[model samples]
Target: MQKIISASNFADIMGVSKATLQKWETNGAFVPSIDPAGRKFFYVEKLLGVPEISDMVQSSWEEEMQVNPLRSYTSIELFAGAGGLALGLEKAGFSHILLNEIDHDACVTLQYNRPEWRVVEQDVRTISFKQFNGKVDFLSGGFPCQAFSYAGKQGGFNDTRGTLFFELARAVKEIQPKVFMGENVKGLAAHDGGRTLETIRNTIAELGYTLIEPRVLKAIFYQVPQKRERLILVAIRNDIADKVQFKWPDPYHRIMTLRDAFFKGELYDTDVPPSEGQTYPLKKQKVMELVPMGGYWRDLPLDVQKEYMGGSFELEGGKTGMARRLSLDEPSLTLTCAPAQKQTERCHPTETRPLTVREYARIQTFPDEWKFAGTLSSQYKQIGNAVPVNLAYAVGRSLIRLFNDIESL
Candidate 1:
């Protein structure tokens, strides 16, 4: 049976504005049927003609999940926060030789969950990966994006010395794994007028690797119930690069929504477990109560909006994130380190309180049994900074396929 989605839901899935859909309808590029209530709806099957949309819905997520590593493959992970990516990659069949993180709480979380993992709690700069040279099959890290001082100068590896990316590149240079991936925020692609990425490309070239064109992977398309995106860069050692081709992971057949997260659905077997969460102050609570589900600051009364937004009220552009109440029917907005902050309020849909720690984890696709460590704030930070687990698993499966191809050759 063909699934039917409202125009707004369709816009959310395709990552386009409602106006664009309207234009497409007028031009006959894409048309929606108007119902008796004057609501426009689109059949999911009809979207197959759109190239980007087809790429996501055409693949079978069930088939992809069946992929398993042909043999034991070893990997090393850097900036391993809360083990979201690590756990997902492990599920995809890669065994970790070392998982490194500098944060005390994050290291504790990793160690607590995976006692067998070699969780190294130290600065990545102080570690030596030379010992793993030519031994490891894969290396990956989500290095925090920082503006390269030597970007556009073509200084290659040595020029990136002080940045966190330098640590990842250093690990790559030292380990020389068959395949390596670097993850970062989606904005990194356009950072400093794209010079930052160009420098990274050159650095990979100097290290004797062939850099594949980087892509921004959306979490929602990979069975994650949040609108998060990560930029991924995968490179293969030049010697093996020509012999094998790396294919990007196919997207899941459907976009997951927040309903799938908190409720007992495809995402979880049980309802969200009770856990500690932040609460709004009395004054803020009153204002938030006025916000309808799926509504933001604009939904508030004029007087309340004036009082709450204060200076931001007068600013240009829609401050959609301000006083935002998440909708149960749609995926959540990209999470921030602090959910209750004035600029990025992540209020519960039915209640006036902020999302709990476990609820936050659910949106990021962390398994319910995966407990976090440290203070409540620390747990939020760890989860917020993580690459969504399902997204990582999809990417990991593709990497495993790349390795399988390399093994056959």
Candidate 2:
């Protein structure tokens, strides 16, 4: 993976001017990430798959235009991983009737945390949601996004049949919640030239719901101290759509930093409590030691940089995460399931080690009291894959407001 090389560095490598590359992006080179100040970053490998779209600019504000929703709302969460979404929604007033997850450890985590809630540890495909049909108010889950089979004409619902999303759609059709939401990586919005999402849209419509255009929500804007982004899709049943207005949650009072997450002051009542974390091997540990807080491989001495990054050093892209250390002032880069991976290193800001279980949870806004089950790696995966608790809480408030309007009408 190329770290985030600058546009100038990339343009030079590609034998093109910066203007020409920007033009390519305008003409559909690939979607890029823009910082708060509008600095853009491109993933060199990902740029190869960028499909041209005349509508590129407009997509940025789509999430901002929509409305967002809900207390006393009965909900079922499918593919629930470690309760990030469920916990937040519960805090906002929705009661969970059932939560289903296939991972045993994740199920344990959920069950251990909330013994009163019904947590079903089973593959979603094997369970029939027909029992809850018309009884649930909200259906929420983060379905794993898989590539659609382009082997035939883009199949809509039927074509989605073997994937996890198919299971999600099946539940939606069976349970028929007043409103349903799904979350996935932001990349899903552009995956496979958008055909996957197109299929999803068609499937939602076929089930008699109005598809709210999905928008990518940046976690940083919602009080999370990590730069994770999730594409959130919400749909309302056609029959009730007109009766309620959905309002997206407003941004948090301020952007949170790793300092807020790791130390006591604002985000937490206390500093990140000491917990188990993974350690780098001696060689990798020594290499990471040279990386200053907030600095990455680029800040390393030239020879050390090359040795540390291996072949990645020769690449134009910075692969910025390599030999990287978090910053106290800025939000941490998006976390990965394993913090110590060479390609996605998330070295602690002042430590030469990977983020600890508690630090990882804090970054994702998980409360100190919440406990994770399973092996250390499994715990990391669950946290890394979650919708940030605070972000979900914000969205949950919007849901409650929407339901308030719906019931009034």
Candidate 3:
């Protein structure tokens, strides 16, 4: 027989507050088992089919926009991954003329939800930008950062050949869009001792674009429920550079919590719907079951800790991710592709397992109805790689401000 966990215990296992659990239950985000004594309990089976609540929130935003519309602009996206950024832009009033993505599954996911979007599935290198030249108002991508070889000279555009950044620059050069935005892991700012980013700046300048001082945007500050960060780089074509002084979007007053993500509260009206999820093996599950809320391997008994940590027990730094459980009081740690991947485990606050697929999507601010394509692992990977939808919406709003200045000029 499966053991039942109380609502508080389950919330502890899932790393959420008891208040959050109660709110979710009240909102119909989740329905736990009720005993004859009127006590709320959660079963392992109940955890299996958590619904995608983020989609419901996003749909509400879409509905709100239809009633109180925003200014419209045209955009072309490169390296589009799973449509997170594109969808956020759409919500902010950007009409995408074309979206290019190399991954088959991601492209399929984009098309599956928004069939009206021009989903161009091809290697970005092979595509010509002549058609969009001088027409697109905005171009955007989350380009991968690669070090320039330098070749014993000042690194220039040619030295960046074979890297995805070059393709991004090539697109900007060809399209001459009024503005372009590029995003990457925050580490890109200091990559290659900052020389890589300097080269990118010079390259953009060579293409007659003025670069903004790149800044790392914190997702938590931008209404995302997780503590993820992305480095953003914006460039304005020389023709429009002086016309607008772009302002990054203001941070929301209240920070969103993991509870807000998975349950029905301030983030959504309806509770998360049931969906599929991954499970831990017997041995791992047994070990995780012993961990208390907000605890990790260090909290385990000494002998068990040594066995679970292996040689890592003697390592220097705190292996925080190892056996780590979340805390309900704070924002969740940055989510990864595999919730249960070794060395990066994201155990639930009160539960003995990793978060479900719907929970993962909610953390990334994906809308509930935005279905992912491919297998479970693929879905996780796609969500992990995406920009948080709300973060993208804030960025889109800022872009709109920038474009408005250009139009004024």
RMSD of each: 1.7, 8.3, 10.5
Q: Write the per-residue lDDT of candidate 2 for residues 318-350, one digit (tens) a residue.
A: 577778898776677888888888788899998
Q: Which regions in candidate 2 have their CA more than 4 angstroms from the true location?
A: 1-71, 150-154
Query: Residue by residue across 279-343, what tens digits does model 3's lDDT show?
Result: 89999998888888767888998988999999889989777789888766446788998899879
Question: lDDT of each model, Cα atoms only?
Answer: 0.90, 0.81, 0.81
* Per-residue lDDT of candidate 1, residues 233-312 (tens digit): 99999999999998888877677888889999788999999999998999899899999998999998898888888898
| Top-lDDT structure, candidate number | 1
- Stretches of candidate 3 off by over 4 Å are 1-71
Better of 1 and 3 by TM-score: 1
Q: All candidates' TM-scores?
A: 0.96, 0.83, 0.83
Question: What's model 1's lDDT at 175?
Answer: 95
Error of 1 at 132 (Å): 1.0
